[model samples]
Target: MSRPQLESDVRSAYDEVADSYADRFRSIEPEEAIDIAMIEHFGSLLQAPKKVLDAGCGAGRMLPVLAAMNCDVEGVDLSPGMVRRARRDHPSFTTTVASLTDLPFPDSCFDGYFSWYSTIHLPDSELPLVVDEVRRVLRPGGVALLAFQSGTGTRDVSEAYRRHGHDIVLERYNRTADQVAAALSVGGLQEVARLERSAVSPHERDGQAVVIAKV
Candidate 1:
């Protein structure tokens, strides 16, 4: 499918189930360890009161953790319902309905940007534009955290971790570590670390590689 169609499908899919999906993964336990590692990583590079934008922050699960760390955090997601849930659940932080392809904030508005597993929905052709948006919104010397499948395949809607809840139809743009690194470089980001995390999904279950980049 084309990039535009892929984006539309993604938005529609998430919007349809945003409420229930948010309720299901609303808890942060599954990602606690990863979030902790990310906090440690961010804390090492940024200081208190640093501004952060959590791209694709579904239901605002990571807001409180970042807020507790003394960072000024904000979240954005493609689904309006998800934004609504996030706002209701995390009144302490700010969130809005927006897409990674076109962030609504001004240039250099944040000191750090984190996408978690958000960018996985973007096709390879469109991924650079999203990354460019990240770079455009981040201040110089900013950092980013992104996660995606590691392999070679272009996938349509797919299921994963069924035990977690209803089957999620997430777009899978499985790419190699090197390809991802090159794509990151295209958006003016340099690699900080690449981690491979184990999964309970049908895809390569061994690990989900994450790349930390600096803008």
Candidate 2:
């Protein structure tokens, strides 16, 4: 899809699912486990970053925890409703409406970045640009924690996600370990650790992958 189409799909899909999606997965359990794994894996690479950017941060589920750790944390999402909810739930931080293709921040603006289960909404063709944008916004030696569902091929729009009022056409690319490593390398990130785990949700039975990378 072209940029306009991509933006349209995202705006529509997210606007539709904003309310229910936030209510469903706004807690810290699943992501907290992932975060803990990330912190342990990348602790040495990260000299205790003080500022963090949660890219594609839906409902700000992880924002409060980062803030509690005394990190100056903020979140950005494509959905206005999601941003609103993030603000309501994590009242101490900043939340903005933004997209990964065009980050609102400047180069080297943050010490760490977290993008959990968000970039999967983008089609494979869009992944590289988003990755580059992520790199562009992080300071040298900054760390990024990324997560996504693992699948074999690009997915067409699924009836299930559409029914839930998601406007975006989600594609699942079952990634091999090497493919992920190459993708990160192209974006100037070096992987420090990789975690593969069984999916906790039936909808995600294919499993999930988390990577800790340094910029």
Q: Best lDDT goes to which candidate? A: 1
Q: What's the TM-score of each model vs. the native?
A: 0.85, 0.84
> What lDDT tens digits, residue by residue, belong to model 1 across residues 1-215?
45434666777667767777777676666553764686567756764458889899988988887777777888999888788889888887789888899899889888888777787767778888987898899888888877676777766654543444545555566777677778889889998877766664553443567777888
lDDT of 2 by residue, 1-215 (tens): 33323655666666667777778877665554765766545434555566788888888887866666667789999988788888887788899999988998989988888887777767667778888987998898898877777756655555657676654564445565456667878999998788777767655556777787888
Which residue runs does candidate 2 get wrong by more than 4 Å? 1-5, 31-35, 39-45, 155-174, 201-203
- State candidate 2's TM-score: 0.84
Worst 10 residues of 2 by lDDT: 1-10
lDDT of each: 0.75, 0.74
Candidate 2: residue 158 lDDT (0-100): 52
